[model samples]
Target: MISMSPLLRLALLALVASITGWLGGRCRADVGDFAPCLPVFYRCWPPKGLAGTPICQRFGNQYRFATMYSRQRRSPWFSGYLYTVPTGRRPEPQLAYAEADGNMVPFPPGPLDQKVLDSQAVEPDYINSTYSRGHLNPSLHHRDHEDRTSTFTLTNAVPQKIGSNDGPWEVLEQTVNRTLGEYCLGEAYVVTGVIPYQKDERWLRDHRVAVPEYLWTAYCCPDYNNSLPKELREAFPTYAAIGRNDPNSTEEIVPVNQTAKTQFRGYDVRRMTLDTLETYLKDRFTTAVSVFYERCSGS
Candidate 1:
C-alpha cells in the first residue's frame, strides 16, 4: 500500500465519488422501466388495455413462450405450443410498443389455417400414433379471430388427457379465463403449458403418449384494476398460482388430499413485484414477441 498526503487523499475521494455518480446515471438510463432475459423467459412493457394496448409480439424461437391452455374445450386433451395473438384486436396497430423473444423457435407460421383440415370436421393424418392432435394453448382465452386460429396449430399442441382435458382440468381453464377477464378486465396474459412424458409414464397406446403430469403458470398484474375500490381487492385479489393438485384427484394419483385444501403439483401463487415479473417473463419466454398481424392468406 502507498501512503498519500491529506490533500492528495481528499482529491482521490472526490474522483471516486464522481465516478460512482456517473455510473449510477448510466445504469438508470440504460434500464428505463424495461429489461431483458433469455433461456427461461422474457419481459416487455406492461400489457395495455383495448384502446391503445401495447403489442409485445413474440417472434422467432421465443414464440414458444405462449402457453397452451386447452387444445379443444370439447375434447379431454391439453398440451403446449408456440404462437402469437395480435397485441390488440383493434382495427389498427397501437403504433408504439416493445417486445422480448420467448423460448422455443422463431418464424412462427402464424395461426393454424383451419382449412389445413376442418378441425371441427376431422382429425388430420398428422395426428399420428406417437401423439394426439392436442391444443397446447386453449382457444377459449383468445377473444379475437387471430388468437383463436393461432391456437389451432400442430406446434401449439401437446399430448394430453381426455379426463383432464374434458373434466376437472377443462373446468380449471375456463374458470381461470372468466376469473381473469372479469377481474383483470378483458384479456389476461395467461401462459399455460405441460410437463411432457417421462420414460416411467405410461402411454394410452404404443403411440398416444401420456400428456403432462402437471401444468405450470406465472401470472402478472402490474397495473391490475388500479381504479377499482380498495375494499374489493380480496374478491379480486390480482395474484395467484399453483403447482399441481393431487388433492381431490383419484386416491391412486394424489394421495395427500384428505386434509389439504388443494393438491400441490407445484402451486406457488403470490404477488410479484415489477422487477420479479420482468425476470419471470424473461426467464420463461426466451425469444422475442412477434406480433402476428394478418389473417390466413395461403391455402
Candidate 2:
C-alpha cells in the first residue's frame, strides 16, 4: 500500500479541481459579446464570458470598459461584421472609438461574490494600479456592423497610458482600419491587445500608460483582389512597423519603460489562423484560462 502525505494529497486534489473548473468554464456556443461574427450580423455582447470576463457582465454591447477586454489584453471587446452595406443605408450611431459614453450599466456592485469576483478582477500579470485602460485593437478598426458590434466585450482590454491611448495609439488604430478598408477582401480577424507593463511602472497615477510604443497587427485575406494587384494572392503579406505620435520620444524603439517613454517600438506582424490565435492567447493567459479565471498570469 502506498502512503501519501496529507499535504500532498490536498495539493493534488486542488490541482484536479482547478482543471475541472476550467473545463467547466469553457465557452458554450461562443455566446455573449465574444461570439464570432457569422457572415453579416450585428449584435451586442456575446452570451457570457465568451467575450472575455472583465466587463462583459457590466453592459452588453452599448458601451465598452477601458482596460477590461474581450480576450487579448488592452484591446477592445472586438465584435465586428463582414458584410456589405447598401447605398443610402443607415447604421445607428454609437459612442466614439476612443471615448467612453460616461454611462455605467448595472451589475452587482461592491466586491463581486467570490465566484463572480474570480471572473471579474483583472489579471495581475498585466493588471496595474494606476494605468488607464488602453486599447490595442481599436474600435475604429471594426467599421462594418459585424466587427463593430463585437468590440464591447471586456476581454479585449488592458492598462494603458492616456498619452498612448490619445496619441500614437490612435494613429496606429486609424491606419489599420483605413488601410484594411482600402485593401484586403474576405474576412479579417484582428486580435490586438496591450503588452503587459514592465517593472518600472510607465503609467502615472490618475494618468494613462502608453501601450505598445509600436502596435503589432496580423491579418489574412483569402480573397484579396478587389483593391491591390492580383499578384498579391489570397494570403496577403502582413505588415508591422514602428510609429511615434510624440516628437520628443526616442527614434530607437524598444519595450516601454515604467518611468520613461520610448520614441520607437518594434512591431511584429504575420498571417495567422484562428486556431493559432487561440493557442497564442492560451499561452499568454496561462493555464486553462477564460475571462473568469482567478489566476493572474501577468509577469
TM-scores for the candidates: 0.40, 0.42
Query: How much does candidate 1 score in TM-score?
Result: 0.40
Q: Which ten residues in a row have the lowest lDDT in candidate 1?
A: 290-299
lDDT of each: 0.36, 0.37
Residue 31 of model 2 has an lDDT of 43
Any idea what lDDT model 1 has? 0.36
Give the C-alpha lDDT of model 2: 0.37
- The candidate that achieves the highest TM-score relative to the unseen native structure: 2
Residue 75 displacement (Å), model 1:
17
Local accuracy of candidate 1 as per-residue lDDT tens digits, 197-289: 234554433333344454444343323465655644542323322223212233322233233233322222223333333343333344332
Off by more than 4 A, model 2? 1-116, 121-130, 144-150, 197-215, 226-235, 241-299
